[model samples]
Target: MKKRFGLLLALIAALVMLVVPVGNTTHAQAADNSLEKIQKKGVLVMGTSPDYPPYEFQATVNGKSTVVGMDVQIGKKVAKDLGVKLKIKSMSFDSLLVALQTGKIDMIISGMNPTPARRKNVAFTHTYYQGGYDIVINKTDKAKYKNKDSFSGGTLGAQTGTTQYNASKSQTKNTTVKGMTSQSDLILALQSHKLDGVAMEKPSAEAYVSNNKQLAAIPSDFNMSSSATSSAIAFRKGSTSLVNKVNKTVDQIKKENLVKKDYLPAAGKYLKTNTVNTSMTHYWKAFLTGIEYTLIITVCSVFFGFIIGILLALARMAKGNFFKNLLRWIATAYVEFIRGTPMMVQVMFVYFGLGLFVNLPALTSGIIAISLNSGAYVAEYIRGGINSVNIGQTEAARSLGMSNGETMRYVVLPQALKNIWPSLGNEFITLIKDSSIVSIIGVTELIYQSNIVRSDTYRGVAPIVVIMVLYFILTFTASRILNYFERKMQHD
Candidate 1:
């Protein structure tokens, strides 16, 4: 009923758009009717963050890449019992609650802990699995971090918005907690020497340690806060019927000891798989789709950046010292800031941090970050393009009785564009490749797609090699097209 009503409301809104102003939009009410909605749609839309192994991580099974884990199995059981097909949507774990609340997903099957604050926003099924947290550290520092007190004034990591993050705060003294969106990212950070230790589930820490030889779980048990930090499936607040349906499935899983029987096997399979063979060729869709999204983000963001670049270029060339100086300062400051910061930081800020001020779709936020970041650099290229135009051309236009604006509009600007076409084209190519940064926020572009493949297939170097080849094809093809355009311009 929730989704049926939502669909009906969407149709009504579409029709209303023809008559009503865009300012006043019809809002769909989200309620406890999710059970009815899934029944009607015949598909249970489950949201998860795919970076966590053994609990809804991505894996290619029988030549098809998809999310697979103990949590996923539980979700599947629920959907099957409900007589519906299961549809999995991957996103950041922190975004799952909002995704459920907004009806973007019918339920969240990620390994989400039912904290009191989270419970207020969404209903949780009964504890599906209970796992205590453990601290993972470099083997060299294992002796250094034997107890909680040893971590005082040391850097620790956890998944942002998770119980582990909160636990890291209360359980350890004077520890600086670094929170990331995904367990994979946290593990990577730990490997890079940026974090002294990370507080996460024992299973995941164990998995990392088993896979990465340099890492070790602390021998002495440092509490990850509470045994009460039990994992549960999440649904929108007031989704009582849905909650009950999920709980029923969880009861079955617990009765079966599915954690040991199912989750361990899955994690073992992921840990063991290392490369693609003739048998795995059917999973090509994951790679193909990844390339598709990368191209789309690259193309769209570059076009958006081009528009921004033009405006900034005009501002740089504006009349009067005050106006010119102000615009120049603003444009210069924007360019420098964007150039100075890592694209990953910009992506995280726009996708995660910017949400406090406004609501935006994940993809939209990513594109906006890419566009804004690209715009700054593109503006400098455009300014250089304009500057390359001979001063004699501007003077000649002025001598012909044309105004300063008219001279730039007719002669100077057009010639400037001709000179800068290749440079601008190069910018577009760069933006395409750099757009992969947005995947950190779960945009699912090429790199993110490959990540899913890696997650699912447990093939690390193979996926990286494949990604490199795919990116080269994209960038190389793009450079060729740009060269063609540049040559065509010369002939014209």
Candidate 2:
């Protein structure tokens, strides 16, 4: 019997080795079979920011589910030209750039500029739309800002990641430039008198001033380095074929004046009519801080939750009718409640609502909320793993005069944990991302950092991109660690 049991254990371990494929960094790159994969998959994923009007915006037209804007139209044309279905993945303005770098999407036609930093990671097609920065001020203050120099010492606003943001930050030596996430947001701030003036691309500014009579573009010599920051399409580095195709298509569209007829008509009402300066360094430090926060929150939540989850799983699996069933129900209810609700609500509940009831510290609230939310799912994963253990092994251990505790501790639990390891790893990956929700509670997690950067710098895209990269690193690292343990256990 002992020999048979040992053979069975060896067989189980071997099976585990075959089942769990270890992680590899190679998956980060686009496959050589990219084109074929798309042809077979029948869909082309494109990244764009839905909040940037005339570029991308949420709209329900004639009862149709659609996100309409300039970039959306451009995306449609590009996809149609490629003879593939287009699927838009709406994300923050900054994440779209990383999506291109990671090859998660084929291209970005979201009115992106060809910056030196961005060019290092992704290639750009010909300038599809002419872009430049424009300075905007409250109607009441427009008379004072005749030129860039006049606005010295005044507070200015610019959307993060835009050339306008860089220009305003660099050129306005005396002025404090507030960076935000979107042009619309900047305009709103200007109108609300929260900002003295705003520097934005001409097309985007024109779009705003045309709609709101309370704002006007400052008539200045328009001190900016570039004449027009030619907006272009972006693709992953080394994707020569895709880049070439987009370049050729954009040229054809431009030559045919289809950009005016199709893209402009669909989105022109949304961009600024004037041009503004472009620059590179637009609040990089602030953006980096946001990414740091996101990483910290993800790590803390997953670590704490893992410990609590194991304990809860053990309790749920206990044989007693009361504690076991009660724990099982509790775990089920917790998971269902969290999974059923929006993460945003839960974040607010913990951060704002619960705090009012009890004066708990912010860090404590953040950790508790994230752990509670994550622990529920972890419990289910642990339970599944425990249940996977063969019943015969437990019975045999008991028949051998082993106590129930000894059988569970020495014979059953180890095997069960190994089986459920993958699920637990997957849960951690999810937790790493879901932790972003805690940022709403002002936990200074990655997303919150982005918000702060936007609040201070008026630059939205760069801070958001930083946050996305931070999240990617966290998830990627978690995935690798999980795979490492899974592989080690299997091989052993």
Candidate 3:
């Protein structure tokens, strides 16, 4: 029985190794395979940051909140030209390059610039649109920031990992540049007076000014470096065939002036007015759908976390140094590694980083990332609870002829669970909140929905306020339910 049980545990641990990126650097991409995979999959995944309006943003289509904009339509056309279905993954601007490198997406159409530094890492298609960088400021502050010199010693905002960020730091002397995650966030910072000005493409800056009277873009001397002016699609390095095909499409779009003549007008028509309640009412379905995904991810992640926590605790408590040490190292390394790293990094690594190794869906990848993260903290709670139980209880079980496994199963865990219930409850609540980070991978959770609502609505704070309330309600109800269970356990 002991030998059989040991064999079973070893097999389970080996299986766990398959999903944990134990030392993976992304799946290897070779010549021909990159394009071949897409043809075989029959779907081309295009990544973009939906927060960049006019280029890519959200709008209502047939009574549903759909992602639509210049790049989205162009992505559709490119996918059609390649004779494949199109799938859009909306993510943070910074993660787009790494996502392509890891094979999480086939291409990126997020108004990216093909700067020389980027060219070394990834290939870019022909320029799809032409524009220049400009500064946006509150109308009242226009005179204060007319030229590059005007921003001297003032704080400015730019999207992180973009050419604008570098320009903000180098173009003007002594200006404190704050790097934000999205264009929406940078705009909010500018409005809230956290930033005196923001650097962006002329069109993006103009789009914001058109929607909000208080905001205005400087007339386009477009002071950015030449490399930042033209926008293009991105692909993994050496993806020759895919890049060639996409460049052909970009050439056609430019020849026909599709962006100015067709895409811009179509995007304009889909724009939603910026009314707080009206936006909420129109986008209620999207919010509800987001809530549903959030709940599902939370429940599933907690369930798996508990399983891993209990197993790690048992491995730590077990005897037999050789086999035990192996399990202990695995468990301890996982706990410390996950707990030490940021959840955002873990989720991206799982979605795209792990995509190099496996083909998990967005929802499944999110659950796995959160579960591993939760397990680390959960293990400590479990280990502490088990240690707190009187040692005499285990001796008594042994005297009654219980095997070590049986004693742990029938005696130790039940008491430990009682002590750890509150800790477990706290972990669950935190998971509900931490799950928001997975939105960076385009999971469509509450935070992602809030972004979409704000994208087209043009009113930012109100939609997020609604999501804040929903998150509060979710955590509050979960706390009450957990308290009920904890009380019942105590009474029994």
Candidate 4:
């Protein structure tokens, strides 16, 4: 019901934006001057979720937020050639298209393959790179199923939305095909013995199998299609001009043989294959998508949690006999339960446990799970802030004939929140970092994105390290914002 209400509110807001004259004028302005506005602003807002390697990943070069990968390098080149600064907005692959459609971004450069269903929404550039499916398995299991045709009754896993899944579904009649959201999940399942094997892109599978002693991909002799299932940049439908420019840029890059020479260096360590490494570009999209979800979970959890905490704090601080006591008890129980339990358990209860009793949308389940978990910590922060207010301030307000509400609003809260500003900032940072835990509930966050990268590239360490830096940048920004507000309040 909460989800439905939120959706309804969003729909109503969208409708209002559509019907209002102001919205009409804004839309008209967007249509007329979008390109001009971008040129004038000197920024090309490129949207991509960078969790995949050889395509995108985070790495520290000279201690900056260096988003590396083939796509990252290419995007930087595109922006540089256009004489515009690149403002890369990280989001899930699905959300990248939405950003383009909403005119929030000029173009998308994620590892998005052109599909019939997607073509209706976005225009695509020329095909850039191509590869196809391969089956991966642990070395111990390889002896049992030496060939693809032999895995008739095996438990198989594949990323939820990929061509490899279609192939896996058709190839094995008695196979239990587990549709995981990202390549990382499949890899984890396979490693943990939850799956006998996984069907994935040949490059990514090869890369993964090469890195681990227990894992290995099917032999290279196994014929996989090398058709134009290549990835391409996407723009809103009818944006032929932008598509053409991107295509030209891609041609220039490939003509330069950037893939063989600088693909790894420019894209971070994940793109560069060592003597022992194998090709694993296929897992890039899944990893990037996961990172995007992590960011979403962080933002949503913090935003909603702030409101809930504020309300709860105010309730607990209220002057009443029965009501205050009741709120105090409820708040205390909530804090203790949440702070005492493991976040992993909380996630499982919401996704799998509650799912057994009631149906829930995947995204809704993730949001509710994280929000509820984060709320407990937020409530404690609020309570601490409320309690930190000097008792003399309340007494002074009361002597001044101020109401209890006025005392809180003017005399107590403002001062209390100021003292707790650093703690609030710390909580927000913790929430952002901890949000990665939601992936267990299938909330595709940063770590989940890293899992996707590792699954696709089979090069561990590099992609994860890159993601850690990205996360640091994210948390740092939150801290800066908190500090800004703190300073402003201090001055006020």
Per-model C-alpha RMSD: 8.1, 18.4, 7.9, 11.8
Each prediction's TM-score against the native? 0.70, 0.54, 0.90, 0.55
**Local accuracy of candidate 3 as per-residue lDDT tens digits, 6-26:** 222233334444554633324
Clashes of each: 4, 30, 1, 8
Q: What's model 2's TM-score? A: 0.54
Candidate 1 lDDT by residue in tens digits, 80-152: 9899999887776655654564456788877777766566656788887777667888899876888556788
Q: Tens digit of lDDT per residue, candidate 4, span 365-453?
A: 67777788777777778788778877888999999999988998898888877887788788778877887766543345677656544
| Model 2: residue 394 alpha-carbon error in angstroms | 25
Query: If both were scored by TM-score, which would come out higher, candidate 1 or candidate 4?
Result: 1
RMSD to native, candidate 3:
7.9
- After superposition, which runs of candidate 1 have C-alpha atoms over 4 Å from their true positions? 1-31, 138-145, 150-155, 174-177, 191-196, 211-215, 219-228, 261-267, 274-289, 304-413, 453-492
Query: Which has the greatest TM-score?
Result: 3
In model 4, what lDDT does residue 69 have? 70
Comparing 2 and 3 by lDDT, which wins? 3
Ranking by lDDT: 3, 1, 4, 2
Clashing pairs in 4: 58-466, 68-267, 69-267, 203-279, 203-280, 204-280, 283-456, 294-445
